[model samples]
Target: MSERVLIAGCGDLGQRVAQLLLARGDEVYALRRHPPALNNSSIHWLCADVARAETLSNLPAGITQLIYLPTPGGREEEAYRSVFVDGLQHMLAALTESPLRRVLFVSSSAVYGEHGDEWVDERTPPAPLGFNGKVLLEAEQWLSTQPVRSVVLRLAGLYGPGRMQLIERLRAGLVHAPRGHWANRIHVDDAASAIAHLVELREPQALYLGVDDTPLPLNELYGSLAALIGAPAVPEGPAPAGLGSKRLSNARLHASGFRVRWPDARAGYAKLLDTQ
Candidate 1:
């Protein structure tokens, strides 16, 4: 059955999710503090700051699903709390007054902290070490108490147009990596598609770790990306102090019957270069 979906924080990822839902024949209402650069005529765009409940109070009725992609500002813990934690509280309060059924919260895999080359799955207990990770964990806890059924997707490093960290480093000829350090990532499209898939299937109260199937050493991934972009590969330097390496297992998401469009960094990089 087609349903009305509300997408908060309609940035790159949120906008892509809105596009996918609209293409699937679902009614999508995108809420953003500012207008996004989207060209879709079918989407209903609303200007509202989710940081305040008053802005979200008058949402159109019958929203079956709500996607929250909060934007954290400032570096301090207090700032993160105000935007992520406080804003979520306001959103939850507003949703409680509505008939929203499902919610998808986009979180970061940094919630796992530095795992020292260890593999983490959905079953792993959250051990967030950094401020960002801790803030997200706090937001996740706050969302858990809300009445709506929710899915928290702890996404790995995000990469796509205008957001590829590796490409940015490579273009600057400043790829730096300590020996033996590795990390995982998922393209933005795949992340958005996964959310669309879950919403379409009505999966609730589940946590999914969204990551690329392949984990690459920092040096190799940077080198490959530079090669693809026709840029000179930068020499590797000593690994950064305290950098931990870890691989993420996406078997659960795959088993859920959603295949990642870019299963590995290599494939994603190839497409990125092709489109560039």
Candidate 2:
């Protein structure tokens, strides 16, 4: 039987995941506040905000799977909680009657505070240094206690098509990084693919780190990107505030038989810059 999937907080990444699911003959339902005006027959678009429970009363029934990836509107703590915590609560409540088999909650690697030069994995204890991480951690914990099958994917920084803020910064000679700070990222497409892979896994683990195979130093990444775009040399700057330097491992994700298309940031950025 084709699985009925509900993508809560559907956005760019959600749409990519929807495409993958649709290609494999699964029923895809996309939910968002202001849906696009595409007249596609494959995807069913629903209008609702996960942060507001009242707006989600009319969701479709018999949804076999769900993907929750809500983006906050602001950087404040309340904003994070409202979207990640409250929004998830409201969405789950709305889907109470649906036969949900698995839920994929997209989280962030920020949950593992600063780790200096250490390598962190799923077994490492989380000590989020900022409200963003704190709020996400809360949501993950809350979802774990629910009486539903759920998987938490703590993703690294996402970069892919149309997400060129870093490249732009490097081009303008305004980008800098600490001498020894480490960086981790997963292409947006890989993130979507990981979600699709986990959704279909019969015996999936409760948690997994969604990152690529490579974890580069911040300075190295900046330098490579600068050279790739023929930009001026990147300057040395302080590490990102609240995000401590640490290496993230994707060993578990790889062992699960899923591979990423872009494993290194240099290669990913090079491919993206080619079109410019």
Candidate 3:
């Protein structure tokens, strides 16, 4: 049976997921405040504010699967809570009577805090440092007690075409990476494809670390990227004492037989460079 997939907070990542579903002939409903003009007119776009429960009635019926990837309205706690927590709560309540089967929450590795050189997997207990992480943790915990199954993917630095702040920074010159801190990443396409793969799985796992095979040193990553884009090498700043220097493990992601086209920064960023 084809799914009625509803994408809440459907932004760039959500739109990518929608494309994958559309290719499989699944119905797509995108809920965004102002959904951009889509190339695929087949996708049904609904405009509503997720934080407000009263606006949720605009949501479609019989949503079998949902992808919650809300963008934070701001960096403050109130902003984070409004979208990640309260918004999520409103969404869940609205779907109470629907046939929603499972939800794939696009969470962040920030929830794990700073593990320094330690390797973090799904087994690592979340100890968030900031309110943004706190909000995500609260939502993840709340989702666990819900009727529907939840698959939480703690993605690392998400990068791809158009999302090129790092590349642009390198071009601007004088960019610096923390001397020894580790940097983790996932290509935008891979992130979207992973969600599609999990959706197709007969039994998807509860938690998966959404990262690639390589967790390169920050300076090394920037250096390679700078070289690829023909930008000047960035200076390296001192690695801070016990900061965000953690490495994420994608062992579980690999165990599930999911393969990313660009498994490392070099392969992923090279494509962008070649296209430019």
Candidate 4:
């Protein structure tokens, strides 16, 4: 059956998910504070700030599925809270009476603190080290208490198409990575597909880690990416703050039957570099 889906805080990832849902003949209503001109004409765009409850009062009725994919304005606690925790609260309150069946809440793997090369999965308890992960975990817990069914996908680093900040850094000799820290990532396309997959899944689990099959050391990842793009070697530096060394496992998501197109970051980066 076709579904009427509402994507709150629709941004890059949300737009991608909308395209997938549209291709499957589902009705997609995307809500954003300032919606840009869309390439897909079939998408129904709603201009509203998820952070502002008043603006979300008239969301589309009968939204069978909801995808919350908001990006924080800044790295501060207030910024994360406004978007993830408060924004989700307001969006859900507005849709309190709608026929919403499922919510695919886009979260981050940062919720798990440093695991020191240990494999972390859905079964691992979350120990967020930064305000970003802390707030997201709070939102996830809050959503679980709601009456509606929900799926929280804690994504790893995203790279693909137009996401070339890291590549630019490598080219500029500003790139650095810790030799011992681990890194996890997922291509943006695969992340979008995972969102679409879980939304339509007959029976979905409560939480899943959205990541590629391969987990590489930070230095190795940077080195390979630099070589792939014919850029300068990356310098050994401190690992990204608050993103502890950990190898994330996507076994549960794979068990659910959704396959990633870019299972390896090297190949994924190579394909992306080819177009450069």
Candidate 5:
């Protein structure tokens, strides 16, 4: 029996997960607002908005697995709540009738508010520094109460492919060495692969911290990237702070039998530069 997978909020990462699921012979239904331009025969792109219960009328029936990875539009409190809290509530209600087996919810590492270089894992309590983390934590709480088997991956700063904000900032000279900061990231492909791996697992833990083995400080990470692009590295000095520093651990994710293709920022950035 083929498992019918429903990917809610099917954006870039969702698209990659869809490709992975299709390649593994699963029936994937991609739910999104603007229709996706993908041409996979095994995947179905349904026009529906997760935030709006009215639009999710024709969802595929009997979804065995659910992937909820909605990207809130703006950086405001209302925007975050609308997507993470209210939006999830609406989707959960709509899917109550469907036969849901498992759920893979993509969350952010922003939930941790620590600014120091402390190593945080799945067991560490999340104290989000801003509304972003607060709302995501709310969503995770709601997901935890659900009856379906669920795995919530609190992902670190995501980077790869068309999502090259770090590289863009470095190239534009907008990013510089911080006085001292820790930046954790896992390549976007690795993230997608982890979700795909969990989908195949007969049993998985309720939560896993998603990040690479390396947790480099801003100065070293930026320095390596600067060298790769042949750009001058910024000297250590006063830098604006965002998402307080903390080392995110992925030991739990790795134990699940997944290896990152791009282990660190240096290797990942070098791969991107080669393609440029």
Candidate 6:
């Protein structure tokens, strides 16, 4: 069943999500701060900032689903509150007024706080310690109270193309790993695909942990990437005291019939390095 989809914040992740929906023959209405640089007839680009209620009010009616990908300007507490909390309120307000049935909010796994080496699943309580995590938690809580059918995807560190933070550090010869500390990651394409899957299924008020299958020491992952790029591996240090180490379980999503194309960091890193 094809349905009209409206995407708020059609930036990197949002644009990729739009592309996926377009390829599937769905009507895609993407809201961005500016017009897209590329010419794509399948996407209807609307210029509007999601932070403003008035801007959201202008959204076309009869939208079947909505995807919120609002950007947190920085790690500052104020920034997170303004964007994730306030912006979400505005987006939800408009969504409530529309005939939208399903919603998918792309949240972050940071809501887990620092859990050392312990696997976190959808049932784990959110213990957001930092500003970013707190803001996302608040937004998720706000969404949970709404009547609309919604799902919150707590995505791990997203990597691909221009968004590979760790890979960029490795490429720039700035790779430094804390000993015994591991990191979770997922490909941007996979993230977008997960969002699309959730939208299509219209999962109600559910929470999903989006991450790759492999969780390796931060140092080992960097070494692998460095070797792939024919660069020397950077030195490693002791894991930070407060940082936690744990793998994220993807069983829930997999059981839901959504499989990650890049199930591990090695496979994802290979593709990213191959492109370079």
- lDDT by residue for model 3 (54-123), tens: 9997577789998898998887889888988899999988998789999988898888877777898999
Candidate 4 residues 25-57, lDDT tens each?
Answer: 999999888888754568899999889899988
Residue 204 deviation, candidate 6, in Å?
5.3
Against the reference, the lDDT scores of all candidates come to: 0.80, 0.92, 0.86, 0.92, 0.83, 0.81
User: Judged by TM-score, which candidate is best?
Assistant: 2
Q: Candidate 4: lDDT over CA atoms?
A: 0.92
Task: For model 4, give the 10-residue run with minimal summed lDDT.
Answer: 32-41
Error of 2 at 86 (Å): 0.8
- Candidate 3: RMSD to truth: 1.8
Per-residue lDDT tens digits of candidate 5, residues 1-276?
A: 568999988889998999998887899988887875766566788887777888876677888888898877778988888878888878777788899988888898988886587889998888987888888999999889988788898888888889877777777777766756887888899989988888887779999988888999878888888778876676776544557888888898888887888788678878887887
Q: Residue 65 of model 2: what lDDT?
A: 98
Number of clashing pairs per prediction, in order? 2, 0, 0, 0, 0, 5
Off by over 4 Å in 5: 37-41
Estimated TM-score for each candidate = 0.91, 0.98, 0.95, 0.97, 0.95, 0.92
Tens-digit lDDT string for candidate 1 (189-273): 9999988988877554378889988988877887777888887866878765433466788888888888988988788878787
Indicate the residue-level lDDT of 150 in model 6.
Answer: 78
lDDT (tens digit, per residue) of candidate 2 on 11-97: 899999999999999999999889988756688999888888899999998999999997788899998998899999998998899
Which is the winner by TM-score between candidate 2 and candidate 4? 2
Model 3 lDDT vs. the true structure?
A: 0.86
